[model samples]
Target chain A: MNHKEETIRVVNLETGYNSKKGATVITRGINASLYSGELTCLLGPNGAGKSTLLKTLTAFLSPIKGEIFIEQKPLREYSDAELSKVIGVVLTEKLSLNNMSVEELVGMGRSPYTGFWGRMNENDRMIVDESITLVGIENLKGRMIQTLSDGERQKVMIAKALAQETPIIFLDEPTAFLDYPSKVEIMQLLQRLAREKGKTVFLSTHDLELALQIADKVWLLDKPHGVTIGTPEDLALNDDMSRYFYREGVEFDRESGLFKISHKLDQAVRLIGEGARYNMVKKALARQGIDVVDADDCDVEIETTDNCYIMNGKEVPSIEMLLDMLNLYCK
Target chain B: MNRKTTMLLMLLLCLSIMAFLILNLLLGTVKIPVKDVIDILLGNDVDNRIWTNIVMKSRLPQSLTAAMAGAGLAVSGLLMQTVFRNPLAGPSVLGISSGASLGVACVVLLSGSIGGVALSKLGVIGEVTITLSAIIGSLIIMGLIAFVAQKVKGNVTLLIMGVMIGYIANAIIGVLKFFSAEEDIRAYVIWGLGSFSRVSGGQTTVFIVLMLILLPIAFFLIKTLNLLLLGDSYARNLGLSIKRARLLVIGCSGVLVAVVTAYCGPIVFLGLAVPHICRGLFHTSNHATILPASLLGGASLALLCNLIARLPGFEGALPVNSVTALVGAPVVMWVLFNKRKNEI
Candidate 1:
């Protein structure tokens, strides 16, 4: 792992919007320092001020009261053009551009570095190419933005931000609309970028499980607790995850580092077989309010092999027969 | 689009513009040959004095006005659409032109009550007053929109507010028409019909020169417009001052529409439709391509319409609005229809 360097430091920052009625502060008096070579996930439930914090950090919204330093320089002291070189941002809003190819869109990231006419030179083109390859989106470079799937479009946007050549990147819900595999891939890509390029990759997302899996550091935020920064394992072990995310029927599983629904199992079943089939049966029964217990004395016992399931001592050909026997006997 | 394809398309558009401009000069009510038109353009004395005077004084200025008005309106439309991120957005759609019309209606319809003199009786001075009032009315509305834009976050809300303002302006114009005398109403109606021929000689020179200065300035906004297409959040995060960019673009577009409407009386459809034609033709939304393409496309379309308006059968009496609307509407429809298959 590369040696870490502090990139962004926040001291007693209050973040939110100023409305017509009054100052509406979302998170207040927060202090945190984001480091290079770290993938920090800003995890929070909806309306937990994650976006507000991000907007404030990126200087889109003014900090209500406090100091934010980028590269140890006060953020407010840097002009917009200067700040743009220090921090790049990938917003959640869909680009309304049409007939523009991915390469053209990504090239727009060089706006701050370009001259008054905003023309791209050889070095800018090289940076754009490097960014496109960094995001592994070279194939989509020539494709129109409108033709891209949601996942592809998200990658293109990340490439655009990468092309900005900033040391720090802020993304708001980068995986919001992607499919399962795409979500995992995007999270992994961000983590890899942070580690390999020594970039501070800060992103806000609702994908708690994925973030826990890949995030080097997690910023747990909620309405009550402004923000708690730590490693995912540390937060889990310290019970801060449960404190912020736990509800009536939802429980945080420390073993798996995931949140699972905690519902009462009405009946217990014994599964005698092992491996994937047994686990599959156990999961299916668990969803139907049946618990798979290791106790050997249970009345209902399910044994699985390959594609076959046996109920008690009778062999059942498929999972349907096993489910039928359980429904008949468990009641 | 690649550089070659874009360059080729621009070349084609320029050729079309030249062809249409020459056609506009040659194919008017008076049957002037191509040879005479060229000679007059080259500053050589022509065989006939009437032909010389007609080509140099009247047709030349009228064609130049149409070209400038067309280019200015098209560029304004492109700016408005990009700023609002709406395909339907145009200079007229923002009520700026209706504001201009309302100003003219006030001067022409309520002349006797306001100044104790009819506008028709004032002659040359009355024309100047009418143009000034039109510019002032449109500027007031533009200022109001700019103020609202500073406070509002969403572009859609601003667009809807602009449409409502247009409706309110038209309603006031209707009320003014209801109370006006028949002759006054007729004069206002004629102005509302729109014309490129109204600007002639020295006035045409001033109009074209002003547009020449303004249109190139609009091109300087190409970078800003491209950034705007990324939408507000990205634009802001990319170091754009959203409010300042919005105000500058809106102010530029508003002034363009105001000046064009002041002179040509709210020549509709061309401003609303020419940008779409350029987009469809180039298949790209990059302002670098769209801006110049729209200028050439607008000028060509305007010249074509002007040619049809001055056909021998119409006796140079047809309103340019009728020609523009009749031609521009179908082109807009076709572009929209084609855009459904592709993306904007």
Candidate 2:
């Protein structure tokens, strides 16, 4: 009921499902806070209870421990309509709408604010149209939702959330089915929403790279039932990323800013190129047990004179010829 | 469609429905001129007593019954479709109609030996007994479907469960038929043919009153129904109690189906087909328009079928169910096929 500087505060939250056998605790003793004008990405592996936590926060499910407060008041204290006015959720499931224009579907976002008849007044229409333009789907406003592609559908879904005019929006895997480009676009849209609209945007994503690139703060769910919340760079610099994705062979390389797996290759190969093409060739060579070295390295040599070439006192013609020359010279 | 054009079309549809009702009153096995039919309806003393009896007793109730059954069935269908979130869902699909049929079969075919009086004795007591039994049967089946619908989240699974329930009701009806006497069986068979004329003047009042009570409840729940189309979780997020909304929808739909069946003997296809037509006409899923549109559409379609059922020069009136299937099946098929191609 109190709306003083609205924020989502979670204290010592423990969430998981239980059966007769025992409780399978996901995340325990978690304390987190999300405020306006920020985009928070909840990053974790599959089955790490990211969705469970999101659902609990949205009041879809109750947590086993601690309480969540929106605007310093307990979440349970707010009625469903009141909560809806504050929190708008975008789920990963497909909506069950057919033959409805983009405008009509987006208008449903204003349902909580509408009267019992669900009629859209002029203000409601303006909000819906503004949401469509916010998502940059104004041209497709008249198109049927069924005809839109997955990426477009996702944008429309977000637009629907925006139409709700809620201060806090929670999206579960907003880019789950989108390609790399679409993923970046969606994340950027969420970022813009947070920054420009002064709304709090919370999303769970498996796209770790995109999340790291765009999120203002990352809620990293790691093993041993712990979570670390900070800026993406802060989490990366603190080496928290390694703990979250702890597998046997894979390692997070801080220098390359990417994940790498240990390889058992004996030979290294030299290649000539620059930029993305060179990186692509290096990756291709790595898969074949041939690591790429810079062309300027002194230890590597290029035999140009195929019919009469010598390198390190060895003559080579073709690659086959080089093999023959190495065989003869070694003998 | 533009708003004005759509409103105009709807008005014209209403007019056509009214015209069909007038035609149904005038034409029968013994033909009467349009002028005399109008005069008789205005309470004029006519020379032909038989004509008056036929028009007032047989023709008038038949037409009104058809319209009511149509409206009731169509609204029932619309509610089922929206609640289940499946376009194919209807009273027949959920076995509610079959339950009503089973109740009728039992009372008319099997319960005659208990007393000298038949089930269709045409009194307050007989009518009340039949109506209550039908309602009880429909409620039982509706309750079962509602229970399963909650547990199983998928629309396909829910539809399959409804069909299975209908099959079970049919099996029970077959068993009851097997045990019934020849005369009682004949009577049940005639009822199974389905006619709107079975509803007398007394039954018409009961039918209208029940409809008035139930239809408004459906309209009042339109907001919840609209939220439901977004799915349960979304509805919950919108502050609707999902369980309560589902119960209300099922209860209202059950009452609609039960009353129509009790009086009209399972008028088929209207409930299954009319909502799709309404949706097609309106081109919107918002229940604010779709619900009332479906009610009026259903009433109109029923009146149309009633007029067709009593086409002049026929030896006897065609079964109302047969007429509805003839008309409704094609519309349903078109909706299904069109949706498949368009991926709606």
Candidate that scores best on lDDT: 1
Go through the candidates in order and give each one's C-alpha lDDT: 0.89, 0.80
Candidate 2, A10-116: lDDT as tens digits: 98888876556867677898988997888999998887888999999999887777889987889989888898888898999888777678888898898898997
- Candidate 1: stretches off by over 4 Å: A305-307, B338-343
Q: What residue pairs are clashing in model 2?
A: B73-B271
Candidate 2: misplaced stretches above 4 Å? A1-6, A18-24, A247-251, A260-265, A269-284, A292-331, B121-128, B143-168, B341-344
| iRMSD, model 2, in Å | 2.0
Model 1 per-residue lDDT tens digits across residues A1-331: 7999999999999988887798888898789999999999999989999999999999888988999999999999988778878898988887767888899999999998888778999999999999999999999988988889889999998998898999999999999999999999999999989999999999999998899989999999888888999999999999999999989989999998889888678889888889988988888887788889989889887888776888888988877777888788757
Give the CA lDDT, 0 to 100, for residue A108 in model 1: 94
Task: Please give the DockQ score of every candidate, comma-separated.
Answer: 0.60, 0.47
Q: Give interface RMSD, every candidate, in order.
A: 1.7, 2.0
